[model samples]
Target: MIELLVNLIVSVMAAATPLLLAATGELIVEKVAVLNLGVEGMMLMGAIAGFAVAHETGQLWLALLAAIAAGMTLSFLFAVLTLTLQANQTATGLALTIFGRGFSALVGAGYVGIAAPTLPKIHLPVLSDLPFFGATLFSYDPLIYLALILLAATAYFLTRTHAGLILRAVGDQHDAAHVLGYRVIRIRYLAVLFGGAMAGLAGAYMSLSYTPLWAQDMIAGRGWVALALVTFAAWRPFWLLIGAWLFGGIMYLSLYVQGLGVPVPSAMLSALPYVGTVVVLVLISRDHRRIRLHRPAMLGRPFQATN
Candidate 1:
């Protein structure tokens, strides 16, 4: 029973890794009061880009870099439209999702059946030789550790750093930030790009590490889940980590039940994650003050610097 539980936790961490990375990126984006709804689309583009490059070059690192570049490119377009042209954030984000889906399908058509180079798992010299703990913690691909590191780094940056404070100031009061001579749009651009890079990394994790294959819409709504996760986490990095693991556990529980020969419908099992998302959102929404306190004050609002 202990072994089984450990295995379940290991699987949950693998599944949750990508979501955690994506959510962390979105957290930063929202922190700057710019809601780029193109996360799903960016992820799709990253998946295909990473897959194609990995299949062709057999270089997993290059493939990951390609994914980051792809996501950043899409995000750059988003910044141009919304930040420069002042396009409606909602409409632009929706269009980006549609575009990414179609564009990725077209790009990935040739590589549909291609097998990608598997990422190497990090095995510690002595610890990895340990009986149970090593398998549970030290046997994951590098991306998994990177996700944890990112969570820690983000938490520190947000809570213990001055630049992070300034970013929060920008999110909370862009006009005030502008009065203090902080370039609101510039900071927002960096935040959006950083969000894009992380989304791409998440996509790379999905294709190169998680499943390591190419398929249509293979991201499978993970992007949307990540977006909802920011809300579910109340915009805090640590809370986001907990929320991601909870969702991941729920998803794996469905599969575990199915494997146990339970008579539950597979369709319902597949819907478990989304259902969990809805429930969490409802619970979070119930506390209006909590949401108000943590949510970016100027989220989704377009910023124009007054010279």
Candidate 2:
């Protein structure tokens, strides 16, 4: 029983890593009042790019870099359309996701079913040798740790730093921020790029670390889940972690239950995570006041500088 429990905990953490990474980035983007819904597309692009690079080059770091670059490239395009040309954020983001899905499918056609090297786990000397705690906490790959560290840094930057305050101000009142000499568009561009990079990293984690293979549409709505996660977290970093874990556990439960020979249809089990997402969204949506209080004032709204 203990062993089974330990394995479940590890699986949950691994499953949660990508969501946490992607949501962390989106949180930053929304904090600056820019809504880029291309996260799914970005993650798909990253997955293919990372898998291709890893399969050909055999370098884990290079694969990760490729994923980040792919995500950023898509995001840069998004910034140009939404920020510079003042396109509709929602439509552009949806289009980006579609493009990412089709493009990644084309790029990954030849690499299907090909296995690639997975990320190596970093086992600390004494700590990793400890009891159950060591396996649960110390036996994760670098990306997992990076996700946690990134979240911590983001939390600090958002709540404790002057720049965080500036970001919040920009999100709350872009016109006033521009009047105060803050380059509203530029700040949002940076935030969007950062969000893209993180999304890409999340994709890389899925390919290079999670499954370690190339598969079309393997992101499987995780991008959308990550978007929902930001709202579910109420745009708060700490709560984001909890939400990620909750969803992660829900995602992995299907597999664990199947392994235990539970009497349930496989298809229904696979839908558990998404179903949980909808249910959670419904519950959270009930509190309109809470969402209004925490949601970025300028979210999904286009910004223009009158100069």
Candidate 3:
């Protein structure tokens, strides 16, 4: 039983990798009040771009870099519209999704059916050899480790650093941040770009590590799941980790249960993620206050520096 659970956890851990990367990055973006809803689109673009680059060059690293670059570059369009032109953030973000999807299909057509390169899994010297925790925690791809590190670093940055405080301030009150001599627009630009890069990386992971193949809309709605996780996690890094794991667990278990022949159809198994999402959302809605307190007040709002 324990071995089964461990194996299940290992598989779930792999499933959560991209979510962790996406949600973590989105968490940071929201912390600074730049809610980029284009995570899914960005991820899809990254998946394809990264796959194409890696497939052609045979260099996984370069391909991943190209994916992130593509995601970030595409995100700049959102930044310009929402930040510079003062368009609605939510609308612009959605449009980005549409654009990314089509662009990925157009540019990614030739690369269809090509195999993706995967990141190498590392075995921690002593830890990986340990009975349980080692395999579950230490035995994973480097990106998995990087995702974990990012969670910790983000938490610390949000709670401990001066710049983090300023970012939060900007997010909470752009006018106030500007009065305090902070560059609100500049800070938001950086935050959004950071978000785009992370979202891109998450997409790249899906292409390279998760499936090692590029499919049309392979990222599916993981980007949306990521968006939901930001709220599910109550905008906290630790919460993001937990949320990713919970979602990953649910998703993994949903598919695994089908293997158990529990009489559930495979078709129904696919709805598990979305169903869990709805149920969790309803649970959060019950509290209401909890979400308001944790949700960044400036999320989805545009910032202007009026000093």
Query: How many steric overlaps are in each model, in order?
Result: 0, 0, 0
Per-model TM against the reference: 0.97, 0.98, 0.95
lDDT of each prediction vs. the true structure? Answer: 0.90, 0.94, 0.86
Clashing pairs in 3: none
Task: Sort every candidate by lDDT, greatest first.
Answer: 2, 1, 3
Which consecutive 10 residues in model 1 have the weakest lDDT in total?
A: 129-138
Candidate 3 regions off by >4 Å? 131-137
Off by over 4 Å in 2: 132-137
Residue 99 miss distance in model 1 (angstroms): 0.7
Comparing 1 and 3 on lDDT, the stronger one: 1
In terms of lDDT, the poorest run of 10 residues in model 2 is 131-140
* C-alpha positional error of residue 263 in candidate 3 after TM-score superposition, expressed in Å: 2.1
lDDT of 1 at 300: 91
Task: Write model 2 residue lDDT over 126-150, tens digit each, in one string.
Answer: 9898986775667899999999999
lDDT of 1 by residue, 14-94 (tens): 889989998999999999998888899999999999999998898889999999999999988998999999999989888
Measured over all alpha carbons after superposition, the RMSD of each candidate to the real structure, in angstroms, is 1.1, 1.1, 1.6
**Weakest 10 consecutive residues, lDDT, candidate 3?**
298-307
